[model samples]
Target chain A: MQRYKIKISYDGTDYSGWQVQPDRVTIQQVIENAIKKITGQVVKIHGSGRTDNGVHAVAQIAHFDIETQMLPKALLRAVNCIINPDIRIISISKVSQAFHARKSAKSKEYRYFIWNGDQVTPFLYRYRTLIRQPLDVAAMKKAARQLIGRHDFSAFTANPNREVESTVRSLGMLKVTRRGQEITISASSNGFLYKMVRSLAGFLIRVGEGAVKPETATEVLNSQIRTARVPTAPAKGLFLWHVKY
Target chain B: MQRYKIKISYDGTDYSGWQVQPDRVTIQQVIENAIKKITGQVVKIHGSGRTDNGVHAVAQIAHFDIETQMLPKALLRAVNCIINPDIRIISISKVSQAFHARKSAKSKEYRYFIWNGDQVTPFLYRYRTLIRQPLDVAAMKKAARQLIGRHDFSAFTANPNREVESTVRSLGMLKVTRRGQEITISASSNGFLYKMVRSLAGFLIRVGEGAVKPETATEVLNSQIRTARVPTAPAKGLFLWHVKY
Candidate 1:
């Protein structure tokens, strides 16, 4: 058996997230179906993480083990041919059996896009969340700084499907930058709880909107309890940018 | 009657061409319907030019005369609210009665995008034309220079819907530039013949692929007849970038 690690990019507009479900079409199910058509083997592929529906990915990593004689390049082409054009297998290579797609990931980066304009541009409506009111970037940056270290981020996560051993996470970076009418919030962490990045984005946006003070971020972190103040930004603006191994 | 000039932007993937045809959904038809809903008047809007089906626009110009009490800003907001999200009224202003969208235009610029890569990025598939083979950007640039001048460009235009008095057009600029895996072909002219920009792009692509010599552009122009060698590029890659009046 050979394990193949693949780098993928997908526009998740038409997908029901990355996980496989009973009836809904998903990114995982589509890719797995394409692999089965190419290799004639039913295999379970593991993704780095599950992205919510309508959340895009620039470089999502995954791995699958199969008994096949085809080279990684040829398999990549064959799998891509069978899958929808919205999902592309960027590159594929053989890996050791021990290298799990999820467990082996060292750090992950996610970026949230906000169109801080009176009206969202027509071509950009799908990729960005529209914020009609002008945001205070300075306030957002100050608030983002408060969340940039190790802490129990319970206030920044949604309910998980399974029990987690711990909610403490080392957020390596949380940066907010704006160019023209687009604001980008980039977050990097060793690992994140369910919906944590979107929660962070939403909190920062509230700060930018003057609804919440910048210093309030520390109080929310110390509380470590989920509250309405930390809303989850829509999935469409969030992108799983990269997974570093 | 107030004559209003509007700058519009649209993602043309879901609509027919700019012109209205029976049983076909078009950009003009949608905007007209939106105007009727807003003002209760059936008014005809004149576009600077017609874009082929699937061709996008960044700043397409148009004008209409209507009797209404609403201010330009209010009318802009109301029309946008009624139209599909894919089409936007970027700006609207009252123009003089003698101003015309098409007749008064002095020059127009169009841009064509080509993804000269192994595969088109998933998020950009609708906006770019994918060419699997690597293109010679230097060669394409050399060929493009030959098209930048006043000339009788009979060989470059497609079949017109109506008879034209002359085919002579002042080609102000024809530039080819590449950034990473994407190539942009920009054309500016006093006026373009039907499908002229796409025809130019197609011919230059053939030259970049080494299928045609760079110097052959002059011969094709001098022939004063359309030939099978110059295929029209797909409308998906074309954009009505701007119209200068």
Candidate 2:
């Protein structure tokens, strides 16, 4: 068996997510099926992490093992040819047997887009969330600074699917930037809990709207409890930007 | 009856074109239908020009007359509510009755986008044309400069639907710009003939690929004849950018 690491990019609008479930069309299932057709073997691929439905990915890393003699370039072409155009295999490379897609040490970056305009542009309807009212970006930026560094991010995550030993994470960066009517919130962290990024975005949005004070971010983090105040932003606005291993 | 000038933006991937036709879904038909629903009267709207199928518009100007007392903002909202999200009326304001969408235009700007990359981004597949090979932007720019002046542009047009007394048009601006893997060709002219912008884009692309000399643009224009060398670029990459009155 030979191990291969692959980078993928996907438009997740019509997909269930990165994980497979019965009778649901998912990014993982689509790629796995394409690999099965090309290699004639049932092979399972492990993603760096799962993205929820309607969330896009610019560069998602994954690893798989297969017993095949085909070169990496040929295998990449064959799999891409069989999969839908919305999901693409960006690159594939041979990796050591000890490398794991999920367990590798590094960080991940996610971006949330908001169309802060009277009406979202027609071309961007599927990719961005619309916030008709103007947002206080300065307030959002001030609030973002408080969330950086190591902390227990329990308030930022929803119910966990698996047993988690700790909710603490080292946040490397949290930035808010605006270009014309588009506002982008970028977050980078060692590891994120379920819905953590969306929760952070939602909370900051409230702060920007003047509904919550900028200091509330620290209060929420120290309380170590998820509350209604930190609403989960819509999935369509989020993109899994990069995963560094 | 009151005349109103409106700015529109549409994702033209699904519609046939900007003009109304029998038994075809078009931008004109969609807008007219929405207006009829709001005003309870069949109305006719005139566009500055027609865009082919799969061509987008950032701010296509149009004008219409209706016998109603509804305010412009209310009418704008009503029409948008009835129309699909892919088509939007950016703004509507009362205009002089003498104003005509097509006849009163001073100049129009159109843009063509090319993704010069190994693989087209998944999210941009429907919005841009992909050219996998590297292109010489300098060569394309040199060729574009030759087209920026008043000339008989018969070679740039495919076929005229209506009889034209003269093919002469003032070419105000023709610029080529590249940002990362995307190349944009912006053309501004007093007016364009059928498929004129696309034809120019196609010719420039050939020059960029070193398949044609930079001086060929003048030769083709001076010939005043449409030939196979000036291919029509794909509609998906074309956008009606702006119209100046």
Candidate 3:
């Protein structure tokens, strides 16, 4: 069997999430169904990670093993043609047998978009989180700096479905920038816990609103307590930006 | 009666268009219904112009008269509170009785967005027209220059419901700019004919793709013929950017 890595992009608005469930529609299930029709085999593709409902993806990486001898270009075209319009298979390439989508990933970057405006533009209604309250971007930026290194991010994780071995993760980057009424929070890390990025977004927004102090990030990390964590930002605002090998 | 000039914005992806039609939903109908519910009176609201099906607007100007004693701010809040999320009443101000929504307009700026990319993102699925072909931006810009200034634009208008008295319209500006895979065509004119911008978009795209010569605009204007017009671009790409008085 040959392993093929595929880069995907999807609008996760109508999807339950990435993983397949008993009766719910999911990004993984949709693609798998398309693959099953094409190859006439049950193909289980492994995603780098699962995104929550309503979260979007610009470049999600996944891999699957197949015995078919089809070329990479033909496989990409065939899969994309059969899949839903909301999901796109951007590229596909043959990877080594040892390449695992989740385990081999060096880092993943997530972006959270906030429309810090009085009204949400209809065109941007599905993508951004509109906040009526004015944000202190400077405070948010300062809070981001406190999360730049390795820490036991247990406080930043949401309720996980399974028991996690460890919650320690290294942050490669984190920052906030504002353009017009749009505020974007970009975060990159070697690994992330389930809903970690969403939790971070909520915590930073509270800092921006002056509801929490700028040093709240450091306090939460040092304490390593989940009870002090802020509410998870809405799933619509989160996007899986990139998965780097 | 108090005349109110309101600036509106809407996502036209779901509605039929701006004007009311039998057995169809529209931006105007939704707003009018909101007004009717707020005031318990039948009122006629006049829009600056009609936008075709699936055409969006960021700053469309319109006027309506009401006998309510409520202030402009209260009226604005009440109307917006009831309208659907896809449509937004941006601002409302009291206008003189002489301000007619259609006749009092000076210039209208329309923007057409093209996602000239290999793949369309889910976030921008409803807004931009995706084109897979590589377009010549320089050629498109040159063709746009030929459409500027006063000329008989008979060939640009499509399927007008009424016979136009004169097809001559002064174009203030027309240009194309690209940001990454997104190409925007911004057109400002004293007025536009029915589906005029869409016609222009189709014409420019043909020129960009080398299907039509750059000098075709001049030839079409000189001919003063309606049958020589190119195909109308899709309605989803066109937006009423602004209505200036």
Candidate 4:
């Protein structure tokens, strides 16, 4: 069997997320089903990581095994022709059999966009959140800087039943920028716990509104309790941007 | 009564067009109904030009007389609150009573976007056309230069019943750029006849594909026959970018 690495782009509006569930429509299920129809084999495509429902991905990496040794270009075209129009196969290339999408990744990046204008733009409503009140960028930046190191992010994760004994993870970068009425928040980390990015964004928004202080992240880090963190923001405004090996 | 000029933006996928029509929803009808609900008076907004169905606008200029005196900022907020979510009022300001949206415009700018990649993106599918082909940009640019300057553009209009006395129109510029899998065409003119910009784009695409000669536009213009021109492109990929007074 030969393994293939594929780059994908999708609009997550009508999807249940990247993972395949029994009765739900997902990106993985759609693609895998299309592959089965093309190759007549039930194949499992392993993604770099799972994105929550309603979250978009500009370039999601995945790996799958094929039984036949066909040309990569033909496989790309054949798979795309069978998949629905909402999902797209951007590129495909052969990879080593041992290349695992999740284990080989060194870091991941995510971006959250907000439209901080009085009126919501019709063109941007699907991709951005409309916030009528102007956010304080300086406060958000100050609060975000405190999260740029290895620390226990237990408070920022919503999975109360998390089994991992070590909750420490290294944060590579956190940036906030305001252009006109649009605000963008980009964060990178070695690994993220479930719902961690959404909770961090929610807390940063509260800090930008002056409801919380800049050092609130430190307090949340120090406190191992999940009740100390802010609510999780909606998944529709979040995006899985890139993955680095 | 005070005359107010408003700048508007809309995603026209759900509307019939910029003008009111029977048995269909239109951008004009939706905005007018919202205005009537806000000020308790009927308003007639004169737009710069009529856009075909599924054509979007980034900055459409319009003027209307309001009997109730209100500040520009307040009017902007009030109108936005009542307008449909698909249409947005970007800016509003008081203008001279002599000003007219259609007659007082000195120039107009329009943009057409095409995605030339192998796969189409769902998020951008409604906004742009997916043209999966290798385009010759140099040839398209060479053909576009012949359209500059004052010329009778009867050959570039799709309307057979076009009754304009003089088809002489002055073009400011036309540029074609290829970025990644996208091709963008930006054109500026003092005025455009019925279906002129769409027809020009269609003709340029044919030229880019080597189906027509580079000097085909000049030949069509010299012929002065409506049947000598190419067909108008789909309205979904066209945008009224801006209007200069």
Candidate 5:
């Protein structure tokens, strides 16, 4: 069977997340159904990672096995035609047999957007978190610096059903920038735990609001218990930017 | 009575465009209802222009007169609290009694977006029109230049309910740019006839597809017949970007 790597992008507003459930519609289920319609075979798609409901993705990588003699362009067109309007198959390429979407990735980048202004813009409200208070850029930056490098990030993750061997992860970069009424936080990490990015954003927002000191992250990191030290920001503002290998 | 000019933004996907109709809910009706809830007075909003159904606006201007004494900021918050989440008031300020949202504008800009990519991005599908074919950008630009200048645009407008004094309007600029799979067309003019921008976009798209020649617009303009033009494009892809006074 030949393995194909597909670049995907989706709006998670109507989805119950990326994973398939027995009853609810999901991003994975929709794409998988489209693929089945095209190939006439029940295909299982493996995503790089899962995003929660109301989240969005610009470029998500996934891998699937299909025994086909069709050319790349033909396969791309066929899949896109079947997918129709919702999920986009940006690019499809044959990958090495040993490649795995989740395991082979070296780093992942995520962006969180905030509509920080006196009034919310209706056209962009769904895509951004509206915050009336201005964020302190310097404080957020200082707090973000503490998150870089390898550490046990148990404090930042949310409750997950699955088990993890380790809670330690390396963050390559975390930066925040503001343009007019929009504030964007971009983070690159080896991998993320469940709700890690959202929780981290919530922590930084508290720092920016002067509610917590920049060094307060160390306490949360040391204490792995789930508490009020940090709160998970809304899922609407988070986006899976890209997956790297 | 004091007249206030408010800049509004709305996602017109759920509403029946900007005007009120008996059979459908509109952005105007929603805002007016919210205003009435706050002030207990009937408020009629005058917009820069009426946008077709499913057409979005980034900075659509409107004006309403108020007889009550209330701070602008407090009034804005109160009205926003009453307005549904789908619509929002971005900013409000007192305007001269002589100012009218429609007549005070010197020029207006509209943008039409088309996703000319091989795949449809679910996140952007609602906001952009999807065209699968590879568009000829240079050819489209050459054709768009012929549309700039003052001319009678009778052939490029839809059938109107009322008679207009003149069909002639000045075209300030028309620019088409493509970045990756996204194509953006920005058109500016002193004013527009009903369905004029959509028809112009439809005409340019046909030219880009080699379905019509660049000189076809010249003939259509001189014909003074709406039947000579192509179909008007969909309203979902059009956005009233900004108004310059």
Candidate 6:
């Protein structure tokens, strides 16, 4: 059996996200079914990580094992031909069997888009989160800076009822920028918990709104509390931007 | 009766253009329906121009008369509340009763967006037209420049069946700009014929693709023939940017 790594991009709308579920349409299931039809084998494609419903991905990396003599480029064309236009196979290449999609990732980047304006443009309704209030970008940037380096990111997760093995993670970057009325918050981390990036984005947005101070990031990180962030940003504004292995 | 000038923005997807049809859903029909519901009167809204299906607008100027004591701000909010998220009334203001939306407009601006890349971004699928092949922006820009000044633009018009009063129109600006993978072509003109802007855009794109020469723009214009420009750009990429009255 040969393992192949594939980079993908998807709209994430009209999808149940990256995981498979019974009787529901999902990105993974759609691709798996297509693979099954093409390769005549029941195979699971392991994604770098799962994205919730309405969360888009630009360069999501995944891997799957198949018993086929087809070349990587041919497999890519075959898969892309059957898949819908919303989901596209960006690239495909042969990979070592030891390389797992999820475990082999060194870092992942996420981008959250916020339209801080009186009203969101109708054309941009599906892509950006509208915040009809003024936001302090400098404050948001300051707060985002504190999120860099190693910390227990329990505060920046959506799942409160469940416990994870560990919450400590190293953040490579936490960048906040305002271009016109749009505010973008991007983060790169070694690993993230469920809804971690969204929660972090929500926290920074609150800081920008003057509801919270820049110093609150340190407090939340040190607290190791699930409810510390209070709310997570909407999935529509979040995009899985990159995954570096 | 008081005439109100309204600036509107809309995502033209799922809409059958701005004009009201017998059975098809349209922006004007929806707005008129909402006005009927609010004011209990059937009123006609005169738009600056008609947009084909799937063509968006950022600042589409329109005027409608109604017998109402409600303030302009209140009217704006009320119309926004009833309309779907895809259509938004940006602003409403009192205007002279004689002000006609189409006839009184001094100039109109339209913008066309083209994603000139190997792959189009999924999130921007609905908004931009994707062209995978490389395009020469300089060639396109040079070709676009020929569109400036007064010219008989029968060649750029789509309709061959309809006889217009005059095909001569003054062009204000035809600016072609490329920012990375996205190319934006904005044109300001006294008025445009049926699909005139789109046809002009198509001509420039062909010039950029090396299918035609930059000098062909003058040839098309001077030809005084409709078939001089063959292809018309798609509606999804066109946006009615503004109207100056």
Which candidate number has the best lDDT?
Answer: 1
- Model 5 ranges off by over 4 Å: A160-164, B84-86, B177-182
TM-score of each predicted structure versus truth: 0.96, 0.92, 0.91, 0.91, 0.92, 0.88
Clashing residue pairs, backbone N/CA/C < 3 A, model 3: none
- Mind giving the per-residue lDDT tens digits that candidate 1 earns over A1-245? 99999999999888999999999999999999998988899989999999999999999999999998789999988888788789999999999999998999999999999999877777888889999899999999999999999998998998643335988989999999999999999999989998999999999999999999999999999998889999999998999999999
Task: Give lDDT: candidate 3, residue A23.
Answer: 92
lDDT of each: 0.92, 0.91, 0.88, 0.85, 0.84, 0.88
Over 4 Å off in model 3, which ranges? B69-78, B222-224
Q: Please, what are the lDDT tens digits per residue for candidate 1 over residues B1-245?
A: 99999999999999998999899999999999999988999999999999989999999999998998679999999988888888999999999989999999999999999999878778888889988888998989999999899998888988643335888889999999999999999999978999999999999999989999999999999898888889899998999999999
Number of the top-ranking candidate, with TM-score as the measure? 1
Clashes of 2: 0
| Candidate 1 CAPRI classification by DockQ | medium
Please provide, for model 6 over A88-161, each residue's C-alpha lDDT reduced to its tens digit, 9 standing for 90 to 100.
Answer: 88899998999999999999999999999867778777778989889999999898888899887878877744
Native contact recovery (fnat) for each candidate is 0.66, 0.61, 0.50, 0.79, 0.84, 0.58
Interface RMSD, every prediction, one decimal place: 1.3, 1.5, 1.6, 2.0, 2.4, 1.9
lDDT string, candidate 2, B1-245, tens digits: 89999999998999999999898999999999999998998999999999998899999999999998789999998988888889999999999899999999999999999999866667887779888789999999999999999998999888843435888888899999999999999999987888899999999999999999998889999998888889899999999999999
Chain B fold agreement for model 3, TM-score? 0.95
Q: Write the per-residue lDDT of candidate 2 for residues A196-234, one digit (tens) a residue.
A: 999999999899889999988899889988889999999
Residue runs of model 1 more than 4 Å from their true location after superposition: A160-162, B160-162
Provide the lowest-lDDT 10-residue window in model 3 chain B: B157-166
Q: Which structure among the candidates has the greatest DockQ?
A: 1
> Alpha carbon lDDT of residue A172, candidate 5?
90
Judged by DockQ relative to the true structure, which candidate is superior, 4 or 6?
Answer: 4
**Which pairs clash inside model 5?**
none
- By summed lDDT, the worst window of 10 consecutive residues in model 2 chain B runs over B158-167
Q: What's the true lDDT of residue A49 in model 6?
A: 96
> Looking at candidate 5, what is the lDDT of residue A1?
85
Which ten residues in a row are the worst by lDDT in model 1 chain B?
B157-166
Model 6 misplacement above 4 A: A35-42, A67-82, A136-152, A207-225, B39-41, B136-149, B212-223
lDDT of 5 by residue, A1-245 (tens): 88889888777777888999999988888888877887777889999999898888889899988876567678777777776465677788998789999999988999999888876666556678878888897899888988888988878888633445888888898898889888889988988888989998998888888889998777777787667878898998999998999
